[model samples]
Target: MPREAAPSDPQDLAILVIDEDEIRASIIEEGLREAGHQRVAVLADMRNLLARIEALAPDVIVIDLANPNRDLVEHLSHVSRAVSRPVAMFVDQSDAGVMEAAISAGVSAYVVDGLRKDRVKAILDMAVARFQAYSHLREELESTRRALEDRKLIDRAKAILMKLRGLGEEEAYHLMRRTAMRENRRMGEIARSIVSTANLITGDEE
Candidate 1:
């Protein structure tokens, strides 16, 4: 079992190494320490990889494979999808298909035959930067999708209110807003509830 260091800046991020080979794991660990990262853990037994990783909760992950088969690569992909942390994978051989699979698995850095002690820090840095960039894009896309859905729900709710109460669009919107304020809830939430109830009541007609 490896010990963790005290919390520090981003440059000193805690790292997790998943390698069956002890020698290779040591080289990667040494390189990280040389680069100013003091918190590094190496895991050889992968019986419960994801569970162990969750327990450790490292900031980044490094997987070193000497010669991986298709199944092994696919397993790593599953691991990558489970964890949102930055992942750097090092392999001895290169194959276009394998590289593509690794990228699809959310690996930030996929190095082929480039696992040099001198280059570990730079590779880790690049992985972290790429992961952060991708995470930001995902967040923005999700927020935009939510906003569009809210707008649609509000429109549906407004139309229902207008038809039921014989009010104009503006009046319907203001009524929903005032109701939301009085109930201490978001307008979108109120709109969604109204739309759902209206749909349920009209289900038999449809």
Candidate 2:
């Protein structure tokens, strides 16, 4: 844990270390403390780990294992995916299969035979940075997907209006925009409503 002399919130840049080995955990914890991290915790096992992590509200997680088994790797992967926090996993030895599983489970940084007291802070920084970049990318992708879906809805609504009310595409779109602005709702919402009502009136599943 990096510590500053000033008071700090537990949830602010808080770090949680998961390691069964006390010696390794102490080394990492000491490195973080030396680096001025104020809020850091260490757990020895995975028993009720999710509830424990929820209570701690860690910003990032460090998982260290000397010899991880299949069950343990799976369990850690579940934890990695369940929480949105960045995870940095370190192991003394690993295979391609284990590494692939960790990557798929969303481990931000996976290190093998690279854990040292001096390297802890750097690894943590990299983990957090990578996670932030990935999260931003995912958000952008989601926004683009929503925009496409909204466009589809708007076009379908416009088509329905043109067919039912003898309106042109421009007219249908303007009607939707005016209704959206009047009601303080998004254009997508108005378009969806129009499409839904038209479907009901025509009894068409399409």
Q: TM-score per candidate, in order?
A: 0.45, 0.46
TM-score, candidate 1, is: 0.45
Give the Å error, residue 69, model 1: 17
Candidate 2: misplaced stretches above 4 Å? 1-118
Q: In model 1, which regions exceed 4 Å deviation?
A: 1-118, 204-206
For candidate 1, the clash count comes to: 0
List clash counts for every candidate, in order.
Answer: 0, 7
Q: lDDT tens string, model 2, 162-205? A: 99899999998998899999999999889888888988888988
lDDT tens digits by residue: candidate 1, 12-128: 555777767565566667767777677788777767666686677665566643423323434444555665432335432443554454455344333222234334446555434
- Ten residues in a row with the worst lDDT in model 1? 108-117
